[model samples]
Target: MKIERVKSRVSLRRTIESGTEEQRRAVLEIISTVRARGDEALKSYTEKFDGVRLDSLRVTNEEIEAAYQNVSEEALRIIREAAENIRDYHERQKRESWIIAKEDGTMLGQKITPLDAVGLYVPGGTAAYPSSVLMNVIPAQVAGVKRIVITSPPNKNGTLPAGVLVAASELGVKEIYKVGGAQAIAALAYGTETIRPVDKIFGPGNIYVALAKREVFGQVAIDMIAGPSEIVVLADETANVNEIAADLLSQAEHDERASAILVTPSMKLALAVASEVKKQLETLPRKAIAVSALENYGAIYVTETLAEAVEVVNELAPEHLEVMTAEPMQLLGQIRHAGAIFLGRFSSEPVGDYFAGPNHVLPTNGTARFSSGLSVDEFVKKSSIIFYSEPALQRNAGKIAAFARLEGLEAHARAVEERFKK
Candidate 1:
């Protein structure tokens, strides 16, 4: 594994910036071509990249029906249960507009409303995540979004993943489309003849999908310009190295580019974790991917104190942060930035990713410093509302007029001044 000691900020920032300009430009061209050509462009790219020909981009009712039977009842049941938990979590996050009455009869409030429509992109790759579908769709539904459409690449046989289809159907989202990659993102942003343009797009994908989201950002709202998955475990001597190793590898198996790092004050724990990671790597089904990820991006940095370790973690702003110290809560208040902070030994990353109910679509690549994970806030818009009675306006008119005049806008001052005319 590529282990490095905690050094300089400049080197750390350079290491985190992974993708190249060439990769970004290639994605931009793909997005532009799809935007210009529409459905015809979609068919060509679907065949060329996904190796599947589609009669229609839309997934029909019959296809969804077939998906239910194809998936095992146990898997379907688990999807339904996870969907319930996700729905429950997001429902609590829903907010309503509120107004406040002033003593002078002035009414000030906010109006909250959901977007008209939203698009969800589910990755179609080596494995399908029904959980991602649940996480992305439920929050929008809870926010009262009227229309929720989903797009995913089709299998070589031109069928959507059964678990993904089942999850979407359970969420009452029927506008499923058979499109993927940058083309899918372009179609959602520009509005092809078949796939209508949405107000915002949510969900995660590969580098192509990430760059496509960045390109179409202004055209449509995006959840975030996500990067590869990353996890940082902040542990102390009391923390179990085996549990730490399992949690780190859990994220590393996501992809070869995924990063898994451990920051602790104990050198003994560091070496123990390294050994456990090696032992667990042999048994993991995705050992090749996990091994490559650990070999390239994984590391352990030992700090002299837990306080110093937390400071380094705040600077890193990892996507998933687990504080596995003896007193996890003691360090919670010190964490200023993290996509999701998992405290205590049992509170693992997968807990939040699967059934813990928080939206798993978190900001990656240090965006957590400014942005946040997907929630009802992402799907809803807030508008401030203010109303002042005639008497109230009159009482405050002179002050308003004076302020507007001081700002050098005579018309603005006169407008309020005229309202006071007997």
Candidate 2:
């Protein structure tokens, strides 16, 4: 990894904004074609991209049952345990509709309603990640989303991965399709003849999928425009360099575009972490991808103080932040922007990525400054409810009418005025 002295905030911003321009255009073209041709476009793209031919898009019940058999009872139990934890965490986040009344006979409340349906896109690039299925679908289910449809690429045999199927079944998501890529996103946004359109789409995929979600934002609500996975470690001299380097590599193994960084007050500690990363990389199977990512996007910066470290961290706004300092909580309040914060050496990135309660689908590429990780909030809508008695209208209608008329909206003013006509 490159070692850069802390100089300016823009350095990290410039490094993170290194995605290809082609990712934008290609995703747009795919969205336009899918909008025009619908299911035909989806079929053609699936064949051309995923190398799978399908007579029908939806997976059958027999296939799901067979997937259960493919997985052992022990593996099924483990997935169930993880699903229960995910469901418990999200269930706590479920909000109820509420109302408040005033002495003037006025009532105002916020109504929380779940979407009619939602679509989840499970990635099928290098490997099948059933954990993503659990992370996404469980939240939607907790929020009372009626129909949870799923889309994933098929294997060469035109079948979904056994683990993916098992995860979907565990979540009670039966409306799944053997489709993936930007085409799957388009199918969810515009609706193929076989696949119905969804009110919102969730889950993570490659750049093509990210750009596709961006293109279809207005058509359907998305979790966020996620970029490559990232992790930032803020360590002190007392922290273990080997553990920190291993944690950084865990995220770097995701893809070549993924980022991993280390910020330490001690230059010696920074160098130790860098050296440890090299030593650990030799044993990891995805070392090539991790090495490329660390070379291009990763960095080890030596800050003068822990306060200075947090200042640089807020600027980096990494997707995952780890505080492996002498006292992790001492710096916790100082952290302003991070999708998820891991404290101490024991709390590594993959713990949250796979088994932990928090959602791993985080805001990437400095988006943590504005956006947030996926949760029940993404699947539910809040509507403000207002009620007023005749006396309340008499008190406030003139002010409302005057305000509306000042905006040159005569009709809006007249509507409020007519409510209190003498």
Candidate 3:
């Protein structure tokens, strides 16, 4: 890795959205097929994509019990601990129904209601990421969602990953299914015989999953159309090169398109971190993926000062940012954009990925500039409440009718007038 020196922050840039037209077409076709054929479409696509044909799309209780036995006691304990942490953290975010009564005899309020049901999509293939399973489902549970269904691809043997099953079962989500890809998303959007349509879908996946979420936006709500994972580290000379390199690789190992960037004022620190990255990359099992990401998207920029480095981070708006300056908290106030921010040298990104209560499923591809990470709020809906006494209506009905008629909506004006007339 070669460190690049820049007098300004304008040059640090990378292409974030790289979804191809072919991917979109493929996802659309899968979604359409699933919409047309329901469960049969799911089984067909499972064999087509996952290379396995299942007798049933839903996982049975016997299978869940077997998954519990297959998992190690230690692993199960860790999952429970992480679940507790996530539950406790999200508990703070829960909202109650609030109402305000005015002296004029009018009442206004907001009702926060959880979705009737939610669908969680966990990826399968190379490895079983039980962590993703926990992250996606726990928040819905905290929000008081009644039915949480899980969908994950099965192996060639047509068995779902035991780890995924264990995680879902731990969270009281027993409605697990053996289906994946855009087809599962389609089934979730349009009800199948075995799998009912959910109020919203939550989770992350490959390009097909992201595109499917995009295609099915109007049919059902999706958490987000997440892109490749990304991380940006804003540090000073006090930052450790080894820690920085390790943090960058933590996200880089996610996939080839993932990004890991270092923005700092000291050229020496930048050069040292770049060298450390190259050295560390050689040892990682996912070396090929991380290397391609670094070659294409990774960079080390020597800014004029820490302030300029902060500006660069804001412009890029990375999914995860580690501020390792002299005063990390002081610099935090200046950070206007980021899905999650880690302070100090000890706060590496992986801690948040696995152990921390915060959801690791963050907005990617500079979307942090606008959106946020998945949270308990994502699993619920809000409805505005309003009430007016007869006297209050009499006082305001004429003004409301006048306003409605000015907009040329006669029905709205008449509705307001009738209230007073009654």
TM-score of 2: 0.94
lDDT of 1 by residue, 1-422 (tens): 54555632311222434358998887888888887888999999999999999989999999999989988988877888888888888889989889999888899999999999999999998999888889988888888889999999999999999989988898889799999998999989988889999999998888788888888989898987667798999999999888999999999999898889999888888888998899999899999999998888888988778888888898888889999999899888999989999999899999999988888889787777888898999999999998988889878889999999899999999998887577
> Considering every candidate listed, which one attains the maximal TM-score?
3
TM-scores of all predicted structures: 0.93, 0.94, 0.95
Rank by lDDT, highest first: 1, 2, 3
Angstrom error at residue 111, model 1: 0.5
Tens digits of per-residue lDDT, candidate 2, 297-406, equal 88998888888888889999889999998889988888999999999989988888877788888888888888888899989999999988889988888899999989
Q: Model 2: how far is 384 from its true place, Å?
A: 0.7
lDDT of 2 at 193: 79
Cα-lDDT of candidate 1:
0.87
lDDT (C-alpha) at residue 356 in model 3: 80
**Which ranges of candidate 2 are over 4 A from the true structure?**
7-11, 14-29, 32-37
lDDT of each: 0.87, 0.87, 0.87
TM-score of 3: 0.95
User: Would you list the clashing residue pairs of candidate 1?
Assistant: none
